[model samples]
Target: MFRRLRSPGTARALTWAAALVLIAGIVAFVTVRLGQEDKGPANVGSVPTGFASEDFDPNATITEPKESDVPQAARVAAGEFVLAAVGRENLPKAWKLADPGLKRDCACTYKEWLTGNIPVQYFPTKGLRGASFSVDEVTPGHVVLQVLLTPAASSSLKPTAFYIGLKQRGKDAPWLVDYWAPVDVIAVPASPQG
Candidate 1:
């Protein structure tokens, strides 16, 4: 005859062990999930500590201010402002330098003027340099400036030119750029006889 089974103590111990194991597993899973959330996504690039935002613009062109040959103060200011704007790649500043009438005449907003209107060659970021900024012509309330865009040492491309026209209401009024255009250079073909 077999004795009746009566090991309640053993049964209780087994139950406790199972419960502890489950609790440990749950704790481990919660800790892991919380750690992952703290870390955010792995694919996101981490920015280096102590980064300066001023150095963010890689295309910025640095130039030293030299005495301008432009005689009129307004013309000189216009030329310098334009050069600085293009070199610094600050389209907003360039837009602010434009007269309100000029904006209307161009039928463009500041962003549109920057993204669609201005030529890449006029940007100093294109390594354009060796320029001669001059007041080519002057009228009562308007002035024209010639910018000779020569390739810098890093560039071997052909030189281009631009004329920027500035206007002001009067001599005492602030000068603003009203128009700008690239001067066309006709490329001559090589002779067949040669």
Candidate 2:
């Protein structure tokens, strides 16, 4: 400390060395940041508890075939029609066919449906394909139909079955969906904690 650098060039060289070290540190920080991995969006099926949205529109414009306008064959085959709509990815159509009580039971709104809250009890994200419908039980005004969903692949596995209940007001009244409970329940994924 006692003997300072006598030459001006020596002092300038020392300052340049300090500056170079600072610049190297900045470059190394940027390189590390750029090399880090990036995580994509969150999983599709889950929503956090107490999650509220002012923009949630429960009344989505879902068109349904009028009972009077529908043909006799289509009117009788409620399970088949709903399964067909779901298979085609016509969510709006299938939504219209669901019982209002089912929606209430799930505590789901149209906005939730838009975000993948399906009406079915259990929905397999993969292996959804062919579906068949059969009448399970028939009563005076109530009928239960079984819908067997066959995966596009997975021939070795047995087809999954979902039961839907329908009711008619009177002898000549049109059938309306009254019950839709999934035999298999899909669990909601937990929200991540910060």
Candidate 3:
């Protein structure tokens, strides 16, 4: 085989073959990389399709329930959970408020949460000044609310909306946050002046 390759024609052919293989490998690698880039991060999880819309009627009028009708504990839990989750300084507190399913679905460890390596791509917590929530639904064991987070006036971040879900193990048990996801901005209309 060495003697055959030593021939001028055979040597040239081998060099061309090797060059073609390298070129093909490079092309394949670039194609794969570009494909992956287009698709964004592989392990970063997103809220499931139709998950936000389940039982959420955009057309229905949203009224802030009276104080007596509101589940105060659940509302408070949801508020605290949002506040904790948004502020990196309070991640541990947020982690404690999260349900097991949320931790699993978020695919983030306590360390990751601490390091802000969470997969919530659209979490609009920067410069958050206040959060107000309206009860969407409340059952004995579960509560859902639409939380509107307002950023500081000096901040460039716009007010953002999130749907938060909380659940209680028992009547006396503290509410735990099971779901936290950004509401689809498209579904919400802009102010009349805007």
Best by TM-score: 3
Give per-candidate clash totals.
0, 1, 0
* Residues 1-194, model 1: lDDT tens digits: 12222477767887899999999999999997787677553212332123455644545542322335333666565656556454545667777677777678778666777663543224453455676765555545666666766767775446666777777767688787777666675242222121
Rank by lDDT, highest first: 3, 1, 2
The residue pairs that clash in candidate 2, if any, are 121-182
Q: Higher TM-score: candidate 2 or 3?
A: 3
Who is ahead in TM-score, 1 or 3? 3
Measured against the true structure, the TM-scores of the candidates, in listed sequence, are 0.48, 0.43, 0.56
Error of 3 at 181 (Å): 1.0
Error of 3 at 38 (Å): 41
Q: Give the poorly placed runs of model 2, Cα more than 4 Å off.
A: 1-77, 84-88, 122-129, 154-157, 169-174, 182-194
Better of 1 and 2 by lDDT: 1
Which of candidates 2 and 3 reaches a greater lDDT? 3
Overall lDDT per candidate, in order of appearance = 0.59, 0.53, 0.68
Pick the lDDT winner.
3
Candidate 3 lDDT, 1-194, residue by residue in tens = 88886999998998999999999999999997897687554322332233464565555554433435557788788777766775444778988888887889878778887765553323445466887876666556777777888877885567778888888878788889888777764322221122
Give candidate 3's error at residue 140 in angstroms: 1.0
